[model samples]
Target: MLIGVLLVISWLILLIRYPTKALPISMAALAGLALVASWVLWEENRDARYLAHLELRLSYDPQQCPGDRPLAVRLKNGSDAALLELRWEVAAYRPGNATNLAQRLYESPRYSGPGELLPGASWNDCLPLPDLRSGYRPSTLEFRAERLQGQFIR
Candidate 1:
């Protein structure tokens, strides 16, 4: 909003100062600024729009044998964009605890699908515990994918 106001004010000042040249210069400048602003807005929001359709699920699976990955992971993509990669931040907390006891990051090397995760595809797998501490059990688990830097095919 401020930018729009400033641009208008500057254009008006230029028009008053140099009536002949101001029209062409101001038009060119405004056109360039508009193009740059649109590109920036599109780049910033494209990822978020695609990621909004991603569904993630996590659980602690004790049935898995010890020394094996115990965190169950299920991800579904409901958008039309194909995801080239994904990363998640996992957090574990004791029951009724506000503070997390452990945290880890998981990065998917490849999609379970034949290629990049296509639209409406799902991936299921298990992840290792954040820590190797014996008898560690977290009643509360959390997953965050805010750092999704993956390539998307629209």
Candidate 2:
């Protein structure tokens, strides 16, 4: 919608500038389309840069525990801009299955008091897994990271 408005304005400007030209109308429309396309492409490039500034990784050491152990999360920030208002969740599943046996949501202390993540910084948090019934070992675990506005930048 915004691009449309911009294109219309550009077209009007071109038409006003070259009203007597043989193909003034067509030229104005094409110029307007070009302007809108350029704007869209620039915005997409900017968003890509912003996204590239951050990274998310999930890691665990199975050897750290004998059998059922608590889950540990490692959030690393690789961007120059501090990530404001970050939230994370951890879920345990039967390794390869999609069903989650246990899940926990935690707000990182680093960002608890309206904090932000600085560049090249990292945080480690742990959540203890409860004792499960026999034959309930989680084969897979998943972690998700996102910003305050539901933007999954990581």
Candidate 3:
């Protein structure tokens, strides 16, 4: 921040003392600033579209990896940035019928680890589910990361 201010002051002083030479410098700086800002905004906007295209696949055999989720999610970085600080949610619910509404049974905390989700790359792992009664089923699951969003419904 200090360096940026100093650079701006220097540039302004040059512009005042040598107007012709400083015009090119000023133009170049403006172009560079616009380029950086546009790039940053593009990246930020893309984040809102995260997880929107997340793909999911599963192989469940309750018999294997008991008390565990059998779900796998694939995230293809279709953007120009890396994803980090990723987390997810797993929810279990009892189907609703008659006068009963869907009953929430389990929800996991933000699960995170195993490095940054990079551009054009993917990360995957299986997480354990809480012991549950037969009446409940894994209902909805979601994942989040920088500019990412995805959910699985069963």
Give TM-scores for every candidate, taking all chains together and pairing residue i with residue i.
0.60, 0.39, 0.42
**How well does candidate 2 score on lDDT at residue 73?**
55
What lDDT score goes with residue 11 in model 3? 82
Q: Give the poorly placed runs of model 2, Cα more than 4 Å off.
A: 1-54, 58-69, 103-114, 130-135, 138-154
Q: What is the per-residue lDDT of model 1 for residues 91-148, given as tens digits with 9 covering 90 to 100?
A: 5555565565453334423223223788998987776656523455544455333345
Which ten residues in a row are the worst by lDDT in model 1? 105-114
Query: What global local distance difference test value does model 1 have?
Result: 0.67
Point out the higher-scoring one by lDDT: 1 or 3.
1
Residue 77 lDDT in candidate 1 = 88
Model 3, span 13-74: residue lDDT tens: 99999999999978998999999999989765565555444433323334544455544444
lDDT of 2 at 71: 51
Clashes of 3: 6
Write the candidate numbers in order of decreasing TM-score.
Answer: 1, 3, 2
Ranking by lDDT: 1, 2, 3
